[model samples]
Target: MIRWGTSAWLGSLAVGAILAATVTFAGVEDRADAGRALPAPTLSTPPTSSPRPTTTTTTAPPDPCGAVAAGMSSRARLAQLVMVGVDPRGADDAVDQVRAEQIGGIFIGGDAVGLLSGGALGSVHATASLPLTVAVDDEGGRVQRVDQLDGELPSAREMVARYSPDEVRALAHKRGAALRARGVTMDLAPVVDTSDQPGRTVIGDRSFSPDPRVATAYALAFSDGLRAAGVAPVLKHFPGHGNTTGDSHLGSVRSPALDALRGTDLVPYRSLPEFGDVTVMVGHIDVPGLTDGRPASVSPAAYALLRGEFAFAGPVMTDDLGAMRAVTDLYDLPDAVLHALAAGADVALWSSGGRTGEVLTRLENAVASGELPQARVDEALRRVLHAKQVC
Candidate 1:
């Protein structure tokens, strides 16, 4: 606090002048405190000192993900949402494809040792403007892709039978690290479907267990290990494929009612994602009460169940549309791709790599004609960015 005595300012004209100057100085200070600009001097008195320079408030930089998406041509951006399979031997050709199309990702299906062995994937990573999502179906058992290089891993059921959940996690970490070392970014693995069929049945051996809680625990552990290795783990066959009677590869397959799935197959999804982030693969099987004949991979209702009911916010991809008989019976590769995107899939994957140009052309035409909204394409592109961690 400051103090002033009456004797210091009373009974004198000079004292009154000093008091008025002090009042002016304090008023200027108050105006500065209030964020108001100071009044300019009438005579423009600046010869005695240099004036203070003005400053600017800083702003946040624009969104890098949005900037990358906006910088591409319409067809080029659409190309990024489609993941095509590449011949494992034709690594150079695949690199050329990504350079030409601004392709989003590639799947390394059917072991050829060329792409996964001799550091060929380094060139593929460099070819794209964005980082490519190099993926594989390294689900272990007969479904494993790189067994020749990394040695064989047990089936999901076998892992559970022989090892504890933590041990399975350690084994999966070793597997994921091997995949990452080979430049594989995504693993379509650890099937969470609930099944009780014989070990030789289609999804039977691939399933972790018939018990939903057990399946969820093992899936979480496996995914944790994959995440620890910087590879994204994918949960497969949304709405469940374990109890289904047939395979979608041969013909259209159907699952039990939604009510029944809620008690069994759907249990893993509701719990697994709560533990960690994983991309969900919607299967080709049609649901009796939900899909109306369309496979879940192409059904809006099924996606709604995944996106809304189950509340899964991670990336959602469609199972292979190129070879699946369920979809081939109705539409060609291009149409199947379109329906999956329009139905809310983030990525449209086709293990059959040809026809990329044909499908892309159709997609461009769809955007021009409004059959597929540009907003929908943008939304999916954002999800693709999320999956690749580009955003």
Candidate 2:
């Protein structure tokens, strides 16, 4: 639903231009420092998800990058941190961009996935050297992207009402198998938000339950199913989006104070680490206690809470940066991307395409001018590359 020529669009372009000019002028003195060699990346392979019961576990292989990341150019390494959306019908263009940009991942909307067959997905995969993180929002029910290809599945609410957590796990396994067959590596699903309000429009039926304990059980079950099927599950809208009444796709939303969130909203995230290496998607909600007023995705304090308070060490990604009005309305696209990285996001998900190259250029400029540290970019790239290898 994001369109060009809106007021927000104009504002973004204006801000981006100003930042570009400023960075270019400041970059002259720091360019040499930016080009200095990075230290060898040390990454531990996270445990892969198991298809068995929650109690079963398996160790993943060694780091996939090895020496490949060290040999990559700054631009190539930066490319690994951006995940962009592409049109399924325009497979040729998407493939061309994959080669041209060396981007880390490609994602398709629910409606677009219906139009793309398995062969089409494979063709896209064939274009990449590294395995592209082919992701889809196949959460089932009202949010599934490939229901046409995978068959219609019940919503989380319906499944929770009619089935046990074990049953939901089995259903997720089936869904994950279908996605893997079509070349999908990641499933952006199994929303763990615990919202009890019947009038919660943004996440009403999407959440498993208002009870945090119940939601956690179903989420872990779903995660087990995905891992069993060889697909990585991305636990989404982190710091919880259930309490908010506003939709981030349209505008900004606010959440409770950190203390209040800890008791209710953060329960699922705190307990999820027992499942192992699950990617957390930071939402665009403003939690006054944690961030003062900035949206969680772009707030350094918010991510600090995730790392320090919650002790989560897995990959952290931003919710759709280009599509969400909470971001698009507040800052230029490039600024949003920089802020997300500065705030400790490992990946910046841009569900709307056509701006990949521009964002990459801006990132290069930021690093050159020392507005963003090169080490920060390297850290984000390391986590992203590691996730692509193991997850």
Candidate 3:
């Protein structure tokens, strides 16, 4: 990337420096002749000129993801930190978008069966040189993506009530296998939030049980089932969206104080031995003392709570930044994305796609202004790439 003009300018500067040094020495000699006797300049032969032992600088080759990343522009690197939504029916559009932005992943929303049917996703992967995360809300019951194709699954609550944890895991395994068959790599499922909300309420039947221990067991079983099926499961709405004041899709939502969450809502996230190879989605709920009354999605303290207290080393994602009222009502799309990624989220998810160019431009500016450090971006990028097992 070095320009020819820059090299020429450097050469001229080097030559000028040599001339200036010679003239300065000449002036010194003249001054000595006119004013006082000058000692002969030390002429000791330059000590053995040890010829620098023919050193060789060997650069280690880039790792798998690093090799691809090395050739990418800064903007492209930033783009890969975002996961945008694409229509399930628009396989061609999805392919074109991925080719254009080289984004980290894609979320397929709605009930459209076109892209998820008949090997339609193959077209998108055919041209993608990098590993692509194809995610969907396949939690089953109230929220199911491939139920129409693979047969509907019971609600989380219903599954817990009717079947043992092991049986539930088996059901999830089957569902996970079906989703993987449709080319989906990630499932936004097994709500870990412990809530007593009505079955039809926001988190509702999506939750396994109100007891934190029960919720944790069922959630872990579901996650294991997905992992067994080769699809990464995302444990979502962290900090407990189950009992929040309201739905984030409508507007602001507040969670219980952090202290209260430690016993109930946050119980399922005890860091266990590990969350395994999975991603945790931070929700947009406003936590009283931890998040400064702002949504956790854009709060540094909130992400810190997860990374610090929970000991979660896997990738983190933001809940629907594009369509959620909790974010949209507060900030514009581009700013929300910048804030999310800056706050420590590995991938900023905006399930209502588009505005990628605008958001990425703002992120580029954020990096330049030091609002979003390059080190943070690189860390997040590596986490995302690792989640895809690309490197």
Best-fitting candidate, scored by TM-score: 1
lDDT of 3: 0.81
Backbone clashes in each candidate structure, one number apiece?
0, 2, 0
Tens digits of per-residue lDDT for model 2, 71-142: 678788788888888886647767887988878888787375532574776667666655677777877777
Give me candidate 3's TM-score against the actual structure: 0.83
What are the models' TM-scores?
0.84, 0.81, 0.83
Pairs of residues clashing in candidate 1: none
lDDT of each residue in 27-91, candidate 3, tens digit only: 11233357765555567744322333343444554365665466678998897788889988869
As for TM-score, the candidate ahead, 1 or 2, is 1
In order, candidate lDDTs are 0.82, 0.77, 0.81
Could you give candidate 1's per-residue lDDT for residues 6-81 as a string of tens digits? 1122222111111111111111233334765555756766533444544444445556567667778999889988
In model 3, which residue pairs have backbone atoms overlapping below 3 Å? none
Instruction: Flag the better candidate by lDDT, 2 or 3.
Output: 3
Pairs of residues clashing in candidate 2: 51-228, 110-145
Kindly provide the TM-score of model 1 when superposed on the true structure, using C-alpha atoms: 0.84
